[model samples]
Target chain A: MRVTFPHMGTMSFAMQAILENLRLEVVPPPPITNRTLMLGAKYSPECVCLPFKVNIGNFIEAIELGADTVVMGGGIGPCRFGYYAELQQEILHDLGMRVNMIVLEPPQGANGGLWSSISKLSVGQSLWHVAAASYFAWHLCKGLDGVLQSLDLMRARETVPGSCDRIWNAAQKSIGQARTYRALRMAEKEIRQELSTLSLHLHKRPLRIGLVGEIYMLLEPKVNLHLAERLGYLGVEVHRSMSVSDWVARHLVPNPRARMHTRKVHEAARPYLRGFVGGHGLETIGESVLFAEGGIDGIIQVLPLTCMPEIVAQSLLPSISQRYGVPIITLVLDEHAGEAGLQTRLEAFVDMVGARKVHRGGGVSCAK
Target chain B: MPSKIFLGLDVGSVSTKVVAIDALGHVLARSYLPTQGQPIVAIQSALREIARALPPGVPVAGVATTGSGRVMASALVGADVVKNEITAHATATLRVLPSVRTIIEIGGQDSKIILLNHGVVTDFAMNTVCAAGTGSFLDRQAHRLGVPITELGELALKAASPTRIAGRCAVFAESDMIHKQQTGHSLSDIVAGLCEALVRNYLSNVAKGKTIAGPVSFQGGVAANVGILKAFESALALPIIVPEHYDVMGALGVAYLAQPTAGQTRFRGFGVVAADCQVKGEDCDGCGNRCEVVGFRIDGRVQAYWGDRCGKYSHVNYLSVGT
Candidate 1:
């Protein structure tokens, strides 16, 4: 009865057990690199989305390791996730893999139930087995997330070479062993505490920037070019709207986002948005407006070019900039690169942001 | 002058991620999470994580964001540099493996192929219209098979004779797989066929007319699968290399980008968790493209702007048009 999760891209939060029961076994896939991506692309259909290559690659790798059962959710709606299970299963079969592929739809949906159903299957079975496994998985995810959070803080201020990597490796090891909820909680707390003692001092003059983009690229340092750490070295506090825990708390759950702010989501979205409305871009638009209100200095948008939702936003982003009078720079990506050229562009953009901030006052400020 | 740091952020339909690095392209810290429908929540969470995860005392000097949410993330983080996923992914790849000629990234919702020249991206292709071959597809398939997604690769490897199946779309693929099973094709064969079909599908879809050079890397969240790895090795007629921390490379790339930017960063301080917000979109009657316009507001301010064909609604900066 080995349970598994598909590659979540950079959404580490899914590693958590989520529900009160059913412990999860966190599978550690080989880290993503140029080679890894190539392997995925090699076998995956050229027309397929990028995630297919990576996930199929991961599935192949895991199968070779002698695992039997694979698990995943059956999603629905505009985004392609709803039907992912079928295609991937077919691909696995075509690749000659033999194992049970379980598609878990939301508890209440067109597809059969999953999480709650898994919970229901717990009836008369060993609750301890479910609880223990779920606990272990949940703790590991929590511990890892907690540790990663602190590591990001340190990276923001780190000036010396190898410091960020050193802390990250240590933190990874510390959280990997997290067993129980309490243990995870302790380990995370300790990791953060230990990280607080870096030699680099916070400069009050750090620039404040807002980060928004596609989910996977936003969080995966390997994918997003390590922008936050670079900003930290420059004495700036990086602000990004995406986070790990926030996912479990916000979108994953079956409900509309709580309207905590007075600014209603502009009625501009009349009807197409009944319910969750798919991607986070819609939500990010509102969040960017909020950042403007919060007095964040400027904005940077990062996303895959073929991405429709983001592209749609990209088409309309000028309005956001004009409305808020904020500086915005955009970068589209696929895989190939000219690092030097990109660095030059980034340098120029930062200079512009700094210049604008200076013009605003000694430091940009938003009146409370 | 003291060394400067860099920041990279990737926001996708499913998740929003952030990363930070130093001048020499070393990773500092990274965060991964589901987008939860609100980019603000994702940004706030990423920032707070940065506040806690980065080297305790160093202050960020510059920031850049990549991904669908880059502009909004840039705004939230006060980014100094804002770039797209392609540039960010390409930049970060070069930073790590200086001579990578080809890159293939497949995440939860989409897939892309990038060709690089001495670390510079020359051409690339992406698939956003299809869910037929993405991580979410694997997630869904794994669920149907009643196996954990982590074991998909292992299970795939166990096939004696991989099954040949159609994979043009999920529905078609699934029905075909079931039909093959009904015809008594060995499970192993069925799996193999399915794999081949997916490869075929990818070739015709995302990789059409794209030349793939060697020194290739298979990255993104899905690179962990061994079954797919074998398929790739066979297709490319070359060995594929998967990097450690492959799942977070985009973040790493953007984080690396943040370091070399000039002057100071514009990233906001952490601890900003946007209050839960409800956002929506409307069909803007403002011209053709009948763009179903969308916008977001937090605490009563329109922060995010999207939905336009001719950049009419996209005007973030005052265009000097007709000036």
Candidate 2:
């Protein structure tokens, strides 16, 4: 069967690798652009967040390209994100596009777990092949995250604009071409070396900013207008508050070693927010307080417009900013967000942070 | 070898302003004109006016552009610094009132509330996707009442008791004004009521959740209206300081920012006003999203491109001819 799925930044590459390793035909969704948003908005509920619309667009486009089965990630309670897969299936069926769906939900007590979904996806594959494929895919995921972390650090200091992006594209291509876990490690090593030795002058002490908020908006560059790269261009270092690999470990891996950092973050978040209001709501508060205590220059919170959990977080952030003596800016993004307006706000925020840095006797340092 | 000056241009949807300043940020010359839907022509006229007023042969060391049309103005003039209107307005306000914490700027097409602490902007909010409380809506109401925009404030001040009108949106406000007028409400009271409605709208929408402190300064094209000023004072219970150069403050603020703290300027010279220029818009068919990219050409050669999402056409080597 030909399988397909929606795009979520570099996560798509890992998904592609897993299915292909299973000896299944895979069709990756097209890169999101204005067309994707426009087509998706046409058929979606008016008030749904941007990611929901984009997912529908991906499914429709994938169906058109001969993909019969759609694989989607699953979430538990509170946030509307958990309902996306079922709602999308209904929408597609109503539109006369019949496609099979498989949700890779984490093992709940009665749900029979990841093994059932894996068994279904592996279909006619051998047990050893499935185990090997899963191992390779997980390593590839970790390797890609490592490469991305290195690129984020280097992109801020690169002397030439868009150089890191070029290197990153090449790295993605090489990583995709790797057929085995060992080859994936080799590709990661090569790319890491190239990225480290890029003949660009590094900024001595760049202004560091913490990025936090909704998972899809943070991971998907297209959705956020390449925000991390844009901040890097302005000579600011970025520390993302969350990553998909960390989420996978906490929710799907079922290993004690994988959850230490998230557990600590949850404990730290308890003082300000006691319970999880929804998707990443508690984490947003926790990370901001952590970044403030960590002496990061500023924090930027990005939330999809009308997102319930993030809306809760957005309201609480101001008090956190006040109590912690750290500056925070919350950007609520919808399809109607203007590029010029967004750029102006980001530029002004950076200027404010830079000024504050100088005021605190912290000029650009060569401490790295 | 004479000491140099800097130039700042604020090109808005309804008006264009120019200010020239010396090294110490003293305003040397200034001009304000209606944009009239042609930003290029408006910019050229403002530059010409400033040029005529400048002391003979005093070189402009640097130039800055701000406002919604900043990109177009920058491409036209080769600006040394391009800033957003918020920064420009805040800079101008701080210089005029050093202790100022809140700046209420209501321009022709938009309005903004800037909150500053110790002369640094801490927070700001601009009216998003709405025109209920901006200058254009007031202008439209003025025109419908057969009174020129310039005299709107005076007419509003003459009312003894103003009528109450809905201020949620422009459409609702306009219809409410007409209903009051048809039901035997005087022109002055209706005008006064319109002013109050705009102030209500501005307070609820733009200034919502903002900690507006004392020492407030109001500036913009709309600041010239005494009625709106009175409405704001009564609504917020704070006296607002309107600067002498309130209308051209954005240009003035950008001039302060454009002045070189060190190093030479990248000023393109006053001669750019007379250069042959043209802008062309074309649809890019590189992908399914056919973005209408605009190309700015000087002397029949493309200088820069804009409006393309993917940067495909814009990033192409244009200077190499056959490339």
Error of 2 at B123 (Å): 3.0
User: What digit string (tens of lDDT, one per residue) describes model 1 on residues A1-368?
Assistant: 44444555224333434322344333445555555567677777675555556666666666766656566566655556567677878877887877567776754365436645565435455756764665466446645655555554555465553365466656655655555567667767776766776666566355677777666556665545566655554445678766554444353344355333312443332222324444556655665676776888777677654555555555555566666767666556554433333443455456546655664565521100
lDDT of 2 by residue, A81-126 (tens): 8788899889899999889888877575337756777788999888
What digit string (tens of lDDT, one per residue) describes model 2 on residues B1-323? 23778899999989999999888778889999999999888998999999998888777788999988887798788777888888888888877777888999999988989888755677777775566879889889889999999999999999999999899999999999989999999999999999999999999888877778988899998898999999999999987899989999889988888875324665667887787889999878765346679998777877777776544554453323221
Best by TM-score: 2
Give the residue spans of candidate 1 off by over 4 A. Answer: A1-4, A9-27, A106-112, A116-143, A150-154, A159-161, A233-235, A253-277, A337-342, A362-368, B1-323
Model 2 - which docking category? acceptable
lDDT of 2: 0.82
For model 2, the stretches where C-alpha displacement exceeds 4 angstroms are A106-110, A113-120, A126-132, A255-258, A362-368, B1-3, B108-110, B127-132, B136-201, B261-263, B280-295, B305-323
Report how far residue B54 has shifted in candidate 2, in Å: 2.9
- Output the TM-score of candidate 2: 0.89
Docking quality (DockQ) for each candidate:
0.02, 0.28
True contacts kept of each: 0.00, 0.11
